[model samples]
Target: MKIMFVGDVVGHNGRKAFQKYTPKLRAERGIDVVVVNGENSAAGKGFTRKSLDELYQGGADIVTSGNHVWDKKDVLEFIDQEPFLIRPANYPGEAPGKGWCVYPFKAKNIGVMNLSGRAFMPPLDDPFQKVEELLREMEKECDLIFLDFHAETTSEKIAMGWQLDGRITGMVGTHTHVQTADACILPQGTAYITDLGMTGPWKSVLGVQTDKILYRMQTCRPVRFETAEGPSVYSAVIMTIDDATNRATDIERIYLREEEDGIGL
Candidate 1:
């Protein structure tokens, strides 16, 4: 089975890039499933119903999110009803919505799990322990498992990958918004990458306007953050898992941009 995991989709432009390239890429590559991170889909801060619908229309079979999932406030209403939309599993038990889901795919149950790392991030439940428990539960019914670890440090992601090697199908990191070059299969069998990167605002800092971030850094003051405008980049990773063995055989990264950033006169 071929699954493509897209990076965090930022504001309007990121959605455009996703809507524009996702279908084309799926057709060109024969991808069977697409999972996207949409926490920042609403104007680069939070996601809403409209943005969620746009992702579904753009070919996302499932949507995953990170810390910003609740920024919109309205999400608390619909999240529980969305079968395939999941948030980090380590959140407090009282939090609405689920953290893992088993997607039935062609006679196989593919479990997708989302988790957040605590290091340098919100002090949620420990991801290391939380993921282990979730996996044990999912393993009861899943033929393969996929994990999206929304984290801050590379070390946390790498550690999780190592711990779950050969135990899960694949694991992809998100939240940093910067694509890493360490896409590789672990010694056991799991496919892993430090980060899938950001899919919005090709020229801005992360996904924020350059000047806005610049002013904050220069003045040591807080200001409202705005998503950048103009052409955007689409970041994603494609992987192939052997259904019979429930292990990943290959993993490849994709970073698409319409503009030339390296050209110098």
Candidate 2:
């Protein structure tokens, strides 16, 4: 089975790029499932119903999020109803949405789990312990398991990848909108990457307007950040898993760009 995991979708540009490329890529690569991180899908921070619907229409089977998931106050309105949209599992006491879900794909149950890192992030429940609790239940009900670790520190992300190496089908890190070069299969047969990167403007500062971010950094003051415009990039990773063993056999990175003329490459 093959599954595609898209990086953080930044905003309007990100959504447009996703809508344009995901279907073609899926068809060309024979992807059976598509997972996208939509935390920044709504104007560069937080998700809205419209953004979620757009992603679904763009071929996202599961939408995951990170710290920015709650930036939109209205998320509480529909989070419970959307089973495919998930927030970080480590969020404190009785959050609005779930952190993981299992869906029947083909003849097997595919479980997608989301967890947040505490280091350099909100002080939430320990992700290591939270995943351990979920795994006990998920292993019994699912054939394949995938995790999206929305984190900041590479060390933390790498630790989780090693911690769950043989147990899960694969794991990918999100939150940091910069794709890492180290995409590889672990010794225990799990596919891992430090980050999948941002699916937004290629010439911006992590999807935000380059000038705006520079001004904020230089002045060290509160300045509004907006999503960048112009040429966009689509970042993702595709994983091939063994059906019988439920282990990842191969993993490949994807980085495509769309020019102003609407030509993508």
Candidate 3:
């Protein structure tokens, strides 16, 4: 099966890029499934209903999120009812929505789990342990498993990939918005990427205006964060998984050029 997992989509520019390219990308690549990080889909913060619909329309089969999932009150309520939307599993049980879901792709079960790290992030359940437990439960019903490790530290992301190497299909990191160059299969076969990168203007500072970020750092004052605007770029990973082995046989980084016409670019 060929699957494409996109990084975080930041604000209007990200959404536009997604909508403009995703459908054609999927068709041309023969992509069996598509997953996109929607943590910052709404005004570069949290996703809204309208934004969610837009992403769905853009050809994302499932939408994964992170800490910012709860930024919008309305999303919290809808999460309880929506199945495609996923929040971090490491969060407390009382948190809204679910962490893992078993989605069907071409008659095969694909289990997706969202997790968050505690280091330099909100104190949550132990992601390593929590992921193990979730895997054990899903193993009974599904052989294909995908994870979104939304975290800040590269160490945390790489650790999770190594730890879950033979057990899952893939583990793609998000939250940092900066794509890493470590896209490859682990020793045990699972596909892994430290980060899928941001889908907005790569020229900006992690999808946000550099000036505002620098000002806050220099002055120690509070200011609103906004997504950068301009010709956008899309970064993601395309992997061909071996259903028999439940691991990726080949993985490649896809950089859709600025003003590109379709997904294969």
Q: Please give, for residues 1-265, the per-residue lDDT of candidate 3 as tens digits.
A: 8999998999888998988878777888888899999989998889899999999999998999999998877796588888889999989768879998888877789999999988899999999999989998999988699999999999999999989998888899999987899999899888999999989876578888888899899999999987877767787899898767767899888777574333334
Find the number of clashing residue pairs for candidate 3. Answer: 0
Question: Which ten contiguous residues of candidate 3 have the minimum total lDDT?
Answer: 256-265
Extract clashing residue pairs from model 1.
Answer: none
Local error of candidate 2 at 18, Å?
0.4
Poorly placed runs, candidate 3 (over 4 Å): 259-265
Considering TM-score, which of the candidate structures 1 and 2 is the better prediction for this target?
2
| Candidates, ranked, lDDT | 2, 1, 3
Cα lDDT listed for each candidate: 0.92, 0.94, 0.88
Residue 109 of candidate 2: its Cα lDDT?
Answer: 93
- Give model 1's TM-score versus the native structure: 0.97
Better of 1 and 2 by lDDT: 2
lDDT of 2 at 150: 96
